[model samples]
Target: MNRRNFIQLLGVGAGATILSSTLIGCGGEPHVELFGWSGPAATLKDIRLKVLSYAILAPNPHNKQPWIVKLVGPSSFALYVDPNRLLPATDPYYRQVHIGQGTFLEIASIAASALGYKANIHYFPEGQYGNKALANKPVALLELTEAPNVKPDPLFDHLLNRHSNKRSYDRTSLSPNEEQLLQTFHQKTSDAELVFKSSAQDQTQLTGFLTEAMAIETGNKARDEETIAMFRVNQAEVEKYRDGFGVAQAGMSGVKKIVAETFFLSREKLEKNPAGFGEQAVDITHAAAESTATFAWLTTKSNQRIDQIKIGRDYCRINLQTTAMGLAQHPMSQILQEYDDMLPLQKSFKEGYGIVPNDTVQMLFRLGRAKPTTHSPRRTLDSIISV
Candidate 1:
């Protein structure tokens, strides 16, 4: 089916509950064809879906599995963004959506590699006439090729094992080689930048900036609401939806509960008292910011949608790679994505990196070695794929 028909079907048939069911699978026909010669081995057709299960498990902002997959003749499958799952308010330009799409592509590509196929993906096709939203953008087409017998990227194994480590990181700094390896992920992307802050003083500075940035994000009425909506407050809801940001089961338990409750309470008050709610929002956002280590930004020369997705894919790749090196990544994107709250943080970033306004920053994340944390949940492969 064409993307337009698929989108229309979604609009008419998939309500919220159906959306949820679609993620985990209810009673429905298989959406993808099983065999093809161009993509992966025919034997893999039976198990490629299983391999994609691992990629679906990758973390995305708010557990939004903003991706759609179609097996095109056996050798190739196209991945597209799910417009219904976008965070239009905060991600006005759909930058987060694009990044999330990139993350999904990288996960599938890596998983394909592990399963003995080299997945070749090309971003938005240049010539296509169809639904404007789906047609113009890049489509990550995974074509199976003979896998190279190279040493496994320790990270390939960690794909399932890795999760964003949101808690405090150990004070020990990363070795030069580890840092270089992480940097190498993005060095090839002309429109990106990576800065590693390991010194105590720099770490302290980053922590302070993050604290302040978080405060501003959470304080703003619109931004806070956007974030809160994506948060799956309870473990039950988290498990059922199979997507969302949840407090790691291994981290400080009471902390996630307290934060979730506090936000819930604050959200209630915001409905009744706007002024008071605004002040509280700022306070909470700032407090949340102060809790991190190093800072890094993924910048581009232009702020187009495709570039953002590329930035996102590269970001996920680097983070997963870092996890392999026993390191962690913390996002401090409030400064880059939220204008009002993160102004101070932006100034600091530009000053620190000697960056100019002409250059666009697509992602801002921090890195360190931290204790392992809980992995974010994902929607099932059956939900994302179609024949």
Candidate 2:
């Protein structure tokens, strides 16, 4: 089915049946309120803030917007992580958090280049991370220097257009040229490699793995509760928090949306029906994975903080490229998550991907043609900027 028909079906349960009520809805404000901040930033006299505004649009885990920026000078800012935003249950070691910071930095650099400035980034100016969790160390110090000759990033134009598409994707495969384009796009700072798999066998295997991972996560009370806490059930809660996962992000409408918000998205209801909810979660994830036309991952030789951040930057670039190619991408790295319960899945994932024991798979995602999706709500810049 075409994008329009698919979207209409989503609202009416015509094509794909009601997988999960939480996964159906167009619940919040429509005009991209948080994204609107970019307009003023682009025209603002303060170049640093202008670029930083675009950086805020970068994709982060759960839209946490973990970045904390302090305007230290006319053209520079100090980047820090908000301790409260850490995903202790899913990402106990802050690996994903650091990767998220890297994604922000990459977007900031691209935005700066688009505005005719060269961004100079210094990572971990204070010190490096210890073995387990991230310490009080700052993520980066960004300084922009005016360079009129600097060309804009090709992917920069798609920054606003890019979004994480969570809908069930079309089964049509990407063209050879498109596949080659994704494989060729490279980031120089880090030694991470982008790997793509589009075979039917690979897709089927991945679907099973992802489905199992979802079951594992939803079965565990603590981990499941962490996710449940982040579910913004209605438009009011979505706008209020503007950070957590919500039904509003799903882009549904009409009766289906109303039903989803009232029933499936309710935290209390989910808690009462843990088994049913877990089954729905697995079903939804399985369907999404089965719909994939391609699967891509980023692997690095090391799992150091710098490596984690580097992979995040690469992941951001990949998202932009996918957007430019008129394709949708969704990260499904639950199996690669660094938690005790996830250890076995992680080992299997590494081995399946042919990654060396010393190497780490930093990111994994499904890619395919998909209908247009609504952008997730974001916290305003004021909320994230340090005083």
Candidate 3:
């Protein structure tokens, strides 16, 4: 990628090439074929549906698009967490689930902007739910009003292009100018603290922390099965479910993905006996950490329902911003999760890194240059919308 595209990807200026659904926003990469990557179809005449078509592309934990919409009026809707679709094992407090909700909202708002509509959002319309649990209350109520004077969001150019890259990086570090631009962009977007580390000592400590965190996270029966249940074993399943992830989302492609699926990967067998699946998760997590040269994180003063959702929005925007910079971004947040068995390690990590005991490290991710992976699939928008 050129330096011009690199700076644009980091949101330094306004020039960006709008992409069609077939393009993965990687500048010169091959054309992609995922329906979810496509923009609002020509057939989507309704304004609300058009915006929602893009909202479904929002990234979420483990590709579980945990969102439910109740159409409230001709131009508004209520958003809720799909109680049935959550990562209770890894996200024991539904923090990541709420973050997913924020990502969906951010995408919808950006889509609305590109089409001359202002998305008016009201959070927790009924009442605030508990910080650590799910409730029936709607997450937000969105009202769209046409705004002829509104400028299209530049981030919209990257809607279909943005993705969570999950492959080996090229081992390049961000220049001082690039890092400063990112820090400034993040500070302007949210109040959360943005921390970037790229030293050799930092990499050694973090890769170890991340590798051990994955081991602890996947060392349980329920947790391993939760991930396996969502694993699409092959393309047949990828097209069949139109959701979850497989080798494609993990940076495997063509013959490698095919061979792995045919010979080694079996969803049914893994689901029944998931011990082996955890081993792969550990290996992949450690390798991903070692492959990258830079790491960043977001932390907040407290952990509440609203805080999680707000940070989710912040995290999603940072992901998009990185995409614009002609760089690859991936979240390696296994060590940031809140679970009993993982607390000791989490505490050690925070203290070692100078994060205060009371503060919550909401997001932890690796960043570098790498080839983009296939977009994670999404079920039909109708599946998420309950009339």
Candidate 4:
């Protein structure tokens, strides 16, 4: 049967019926409240919420926005991990989640600086925990204090524009000076080592590792389901969830988005059988990796919870710095994931790069020029507040 007939017949049942409207609705570029970023300065209200307004926009894995804020005082709040918002299948160690906590904290600090306040973040306030385990401890105890002389962070200006660009790059490398600027742009808040692999041979090998890693990642049913659960199939889903990613975030637009959503994309199909989706993901990963000419990763000497969070802060700054330089950056973290299936490739990748055996590679991503992709949506501030 043709796609139309198949869809109509499937519509008779519950699962396929919902796709009718969502399929066509995906074509329009509706104004989503989540994508419209009005930073803390616009509200001028509660200091906690004001700082949080921008903090919610921090780059996170799968756009999960896995953070919980509890109001501790008039000017203070505590950040916790929303255990529900974790990638257990892909990120078994909760390392990425803690990293996400770090990014959130970084953005909150920057927002406070821009708003004439200093955000003092005390890590693991209730006490630290093991990186391999999740605990009831607070990730950070943040206090917002008035500081009339606070200097706004330069990266703060790029907050609204910084995004994880996923489109194929222009196949170019950064100049030696550009690389030096990145190498030297260390902030006092973080001490992670930032390493780059942009030489012709390094790029080729890293690209192969990236593509193979993705192939391994999508080869599992549970892993594919974990990812598809967070995938917004259309614009309606985007509006309904106000989080997660969609074709638009993949840099699909004009005819590309319409074609995918109309003919190929369907949530029901992906949910029922993810093998096809997995294959497509691998293909896309290969294409994206093959076209890129530069790769970078962050490493830390230890794998403590504090170390992961600190690395996250540094990654956030690099993302913002690259944005300021008109460079597009996208994180390809499949090889770095801590899942069982990915460990072998992970080991080989680390050894091949001559990286320290004990050091943790916190983040691995590509950097080059590409058109801006859609900004991943963020949930409402109310969604992340602890009652």
Candidate 5:
């Protein structure tokens, strides 16, 4: 059967609840296809490919998987931006994209070292694409060399365990010891400072701002439509794309899934009640923010490309540390994005957080204890590699 006919038949033949339960229980073929257990072990024999396999799994904004790779030689590869993956509505200036690339480079370097190689990375070899949309310019050039003396990064072990936990976090504050461990990154690094807001007053204020920001985003017809376009309502779309924002990744289950599939996931329903949907979005964001044990923001001295990349590296380390400490971290950065609608919120956020005019808030997130969450699906290395 043709693709359209198959989808139509599924929609018409099975009732919504029955289909949702079946898909959730059986855990359809798309899940299996998207979640390839092993990485590049059976197909590609090259060590470079093996390293790239782990790199492809790095956390990125919206799970866009925006990095493209080209093998330069036996020991080197060039990283490029996949222009099509750009989220213009959300990330107008591509700051998040650069940060995601930085995360990829950091992971690739760590993987290379773990595999008995030292990775040398040269950023923007073809000249920097500063504060603009990603073009055909190369982001970085990675050269890997065998190093018997180099030790694998301690953070390497947590790569698979680290994920953006979207579940509501426990409200209890962190112990002095846990706080000390998380603060060490700030103490040791000159590139960025980590600011933690755990007081009830601060959390309440931040939550209010976050919910307002989220409401603004949802109320924007263009932004909402863009986000809705990426939502994978069924097992078929989720498995096929293996990317974007999927309902499964949102931690929806059973009755919630059925309701979402029947109402919220339907474009027609959303169009009919965009205002209600926006209100629902606000409520969800408020609940998530209110449950935070702490709200952490990483601030840099400048908003340059190099600083943004450094923020990515620091953010990755922070994520790994969160995983190691048995905690959850979720990025809640809508207020910091660089779109026109976000300008006022950005100014207010900086003032509220005591961030100076010259300084930039590179990342903001809520962190605390939470139930274990599932990892998002990733594309295979073969699909991402250019040559």
Candidate 6:
């Protein structure tokens, strides 16, 4: 269906659903709230749009921007996936999209907490309905809760600052105490398993395997194509249009530039031997693996969608904790994407820890002490939520 029809079906008043709810300050306020009025006096009708504004900023897989919020009442909201945003080729079963929704619920909950409220999330509250529902997937629902303590996460203060740093991380190991702190962050969350390896030799082996994985990733025609598609080649493009799985640095802009320039400067030649481009891609990936201090795998007990979202939220929280502890985290999901040869990868991963096969790896990251990097751009709250 068209965007307009879809909006209408969601009861968003057709074309008017994209409306922005900006909160105006009366006396002296530096920043204007998106939902017009603020303060406790405002009822749910007065603030539903405001609540959704924060939810829109939640991150999604591949920047597919797959979520659309339907404000059901003053204190209730529904989270739906925009099927048009699905990555059928890469995520054939829409598992990633569901995980994205989990991230959405987390964001909504956090945002609500910031506003002195809590969200009561009910996944698939109703039976399947239209394309909004994934194949046999239940409708996800969330209700707002009034709580005494709605204090935002201290880490939430760094939401804008938090980003996935893909650059070469500094070679530094976490101290025993620091390692314990990271472990604590995972221990609180029951859904995920944090696998930490400290041995320099073990890290080196994992790094080498990751390098090989990168080589294989670039060599595969389909995988390379997906990577190329997500590369936002330049600053101007990124600033103007914000949404892509990855951003390419100006000078070392990887296959992204090769692809973009192909359309602009060398379209014909690129259409020939795309495999030749894989060389630099491989090196870049390997460099990413080589320049890190430690390697960790965030695995889930089961491969359920809820578990994936839990993994995302847990990882995001841990990343902030890492930042606060004067460390850096760069996700190395490339190796885990090697679904075919994951046996050896799993074997190697299990060599250090007695992890089981039932546990699915959600994200792989390298952590160390590194200089803080620039923040990546995000979609405006205006473009995100609906009331």
Candidate topping TM-score: 3
Model 2, span 196-230: residue lDDT tens = 88888888888888998888777777777777667
Using lDDT as the yardstick, the better of models 1 and 4 is: 4
For residues 138-170, write the lDDT of model 1, one tens digit per residue.
456666666767334445666644566555544
lDDT of 6 at 215: 74
Give the C-alpha miss distance for residue 381 in model 4, angstroms.
Answer: 0.6
How does each model score on lDDT? Answer: 0.58, 0.74, 0.81, 0.80, 0.73, 0.57
Using alpha carbons, what is the TM-score of model 2? 0.88
Q: TM-score each candidate.
A: 0.73, 0.88, 0.91, 0.90, 0.86, 0.74
For candidate 6, write residues 13-112 as lDDT tens digits: 1111122333223111212111222322344454555566545545566666776666676677677777667765455556556666766666566656
lDDT (Cα) of model 4: 0.80
How many backbone clashes does every candidate have?
18, 1, 3, 0, 0, 11
Candidate 6 stretches greater than 4 Å from native? 1-48, 127-133, 136-139, 245-273, 338-354, 380-387
lDDT, candidate 5, 176-239, per-residue tens: 6788888975567555888888898988899999998998888787777666666566656667
Give candidate 3 misplaced runs (Cα > 4 Å).
Answer: 1-31, 35-38
Taking the tens digit of each residue's C-alpha lDDT, what string does model 3 give over 1-387?
Answer: 332332222222112222344444322233344545445667779899888888898889888889999999789999999999988898998888899999999989888988899999999999888988799999999999999988877888777768888777767777778889889998887999999999988888999999999999889998888888889998788888877887666577665566667776777778876877777777777677887889999999988888888888888888888888988898887888888999999999999999999999988999998767777788888899997
List runs of model 2 lying over 4 Å from the truth.
1-38, 41-43, 187-190, 271-275
Q: Model 5, 14: alpha-carbon shift in Å?
A: 25
Models, CA RMSD each: 11.4, 6.1, 6.8, 7.3, 7.3, 10.8
Worst 10-residue lDDT window for candidate 1 reads 29-38
